[model samples]
Target: MKKFMNEAGSLAADSLDGFVGAHDDLVAFGQDRKHVRRRVLSPGKVAIIAGGGAGHEPMHVGFIGKGMLDAACTGHVFTSPTPDQILGAIRETDNGAGVLLIVKNYDGDLMNFEMAAEMAVSDGGHRIETLIVNDDIAVERTARGTGRRGVAGTLVVEKIVGAAAEAGLDLFSLKAVGESAIAATRTMGVALKGATVPQTTRETFVLGETEMEVGVGIHGEPGRSRQDIADAATIASLICRQILDDLEPAQGQRILLFVNGLGATPPSELYLMFGLARRFFEAHGLVVCRKLVGTYATSLDMAGMSITVTLLDDASLGLWDAPVHSAALHW
Candidate 1:
């Protein structure tokens, strides 16, 4: 709760204002600060919009720019954006090729984005499609009763889908590409420490110095189990096993290995985990063709990291390599 904010009620708005001000050349606030969009819109291109709760910085918002998301609607900390906010983004960004909404598979996010899509078609006369990303393999379908939560693998979906949209792909085509990417991706995370919400002083969960939360969710949801903390190699092996077992890629499959820090982890440790994870995947007969390591998706200073395994083909690899200019990712 030691956040640098004047008040809890205005935390989201104030943060948005600062972010917009800093990246004024790259992005601008959507109607009434409901969302953030690329300052220079690409007319006639299929608009790619992604959004979810805040706290996971440089995510939906940071990915908004050339060759990526055209607009990103954000909710309050760890809260889903309203349907009205989503609809406004669609209406404002949709040029002529329609829009594609890249949503994570959280209950609030799914419902709100779906409602906005319906509204856009019926009320605004805009063609809209939605791609839901549920890449977290931490829980079985029965665990949360909402299927696996979308975790860090969302970055892979957004980048590939965004490139496709920027390349003039139609709404349906973009949806197909995004769906395939979703099908090929899987993610799992571990938490060394829980995050403290801006509104409260208590951490999301308490852990002893020697303990860790395995397969934790971005919103601090409980993972499969909590156990004694192990070394990086041991931890990386367990996580890699979960992801590879779920994804089930063929032998020699070229893959993109992404190591994402959950808010508080540092780059030095991130790279160490990445190195270990890469070695583990390579041992399983998978080719570590492309890799990304950074604090892309986070949970409000939670000390942990998630590993994402994405099976990549030539087309998808090209899309991932395509030019992108955003606050968090660029190439």
Candidate 2:
């Protein structure tokens, strides 16, 4: 419940103002600050826009820059951006080449983006396509029948697709690239501690000091299971096994391994987890060609991390290596 801000009601907005100011050279706000957009866009290039809730810092917003999303529509903490907000982004970012929306597989996100895309096409006559990322291997179907929730694998999708878009790929071609990346990606997360939503001033979930939740969602949603806390090696083994079994990458397959901290985890621990995860992958006969480790996608101050594996081919590999300059990711 302890946070520095003007007020709980304005936490999301306040934080955004500071972020926009800090990275103004790279990004700017759309009308009414509905979205964060790249300061300079490559005219006629496919515009890549990704968005979702607000608490996952350096995600949709932090990723707005060269070789990545041209714009990002952000909502209140853990809330979906409204259709109007999304539509505005589409209108502003779309040049001749059209806009691609990268949305996570959450009910609110899916519905709102769909509404906006429909509006943009029907009203604005803008060509817009949507790519839904469902790489979280933790859940095949929610109680409401929603498929796998998008987790840290979202970064993989955005980066690869962004690079392709920057390379002048058309709308459908970029969509194809995004779909291929999603198909090759799988992720799972574990929570050592729960996150506290500023508005409610309460932790999204409670965990005993000795308990941990496996396969947790970014929104602090219930995970696959809760169990007594175990050592890092045990935890890494359990998570890597689940990911490899599901992804089923062929032996010697090249892959990009990402270890994303969920807001509160420290770099030291994240790196340790990465080492353990790499061992697991190498032991299984996979080649770790590209690797990223950091606090990329996060739940508001949640102390945990997620592991993502994307089977990589030559085309995807080059796209990943392509130059990118964003608030959160650059190479």
Candidate 3:
């Protein structure tokens, strides 16, 4: 019930206004509060567009800069952006090389972005490609049911594919690289406390002083189950096991490990998680090529952390190592 914002106003516009004001060099405000940022539109290189709810800051918009996304659409907190907003971003970012929509696997996001893509094609004959990220291993897998959800691993996919596009890769080749990165990435999360949305002046979920939720989503959705609070090593072990079970990284393979904080979790806790994750990877004979630790992707005010691992080959590693300058992440 503790928040510091007016709850009876337009959350989306207010948030975007502040974001654009602070990062004018990296981003600009577009119609309908969309985020328009300059991108490297090399001839024959496909444009990249990504977006979703507003709480996951520095995600779609934070990534809009050199060697990353071309533009981003910002919806209300915990809600999907409308088709028109998404279409506007596509139109603004498109430079005749076609556009690629990087969508999360949430139901609302999938439906809305697909509708926007269809509209873009029907109205302007702009070729649009899409890559849906679904790397959360905590969710169920069924052909006819809601598959895995996209979590922290999405940033890695976007980073790799963005580099490919920046290097003037064609749409087909970028799609291939994107799909490969998506397939190789996996994520799992743990929540120590719940988050409060600005619109709702209350916590989304409840947790006792000595309990935690494993495999929690970024939007405060219920995770696998609650468990007694344990030490950081034990918690990291549990999360890493789930991700390793899903990905099965080989002994000699190089991997990118990301320890992401879900808003309120401090950097110290994230570093503790990273230490344990590094041990686990080393014990399994996996070569840790690079590691990124911070609140790259986050929930509103959720006190938790998520881990993402991407198996890397030479080409994937090269793309990931490319220089990237964005509002949230800099490399």
CA lDDT, every model vs. true structure? 0.93, 0.94, 0.86
TM-scores of the models, in the order given: 0.98, 0.98, 0.96
CA lDDT, candidate 2, residue 93: 93
lDDT score of model 1? Answer: 0.93
Model 1, span 1-331: residue lDDT tens: 6777888767777888898899998999998989999999998999999999988987889999999999999999999999999999998999989999999999999999999999999998999999889999987877646798898999999999999988989999999999999999999999999988887767999899999999999999999999999999999999999988888889999999999999999999999999999999999999999999999999988999999999999999999999999988989
Winning model by TM-score: 2
Better of 1 and 3 by lDDT: 1
- Model 3, 132: alpha-carbon shift in Å? 0.5
- Candidate 1 regions with alpha-carbon error over 4 angstroms: none
Report the C-alpha lDDT of model 3 over 247-322, residue by residue, as the tens digit.
8877788999999999999999899899999999888888888999999788888999999999999999999999
- Give the Cα error of residue 322 in candidate 3, in Å: 0.7
Give the clashing residue pairs of candidate 1, or none.
none
Better of 1 and 2 by lDDT: 2
Which 10 successive residues of model 2 have the least lDDT summed?
138-147
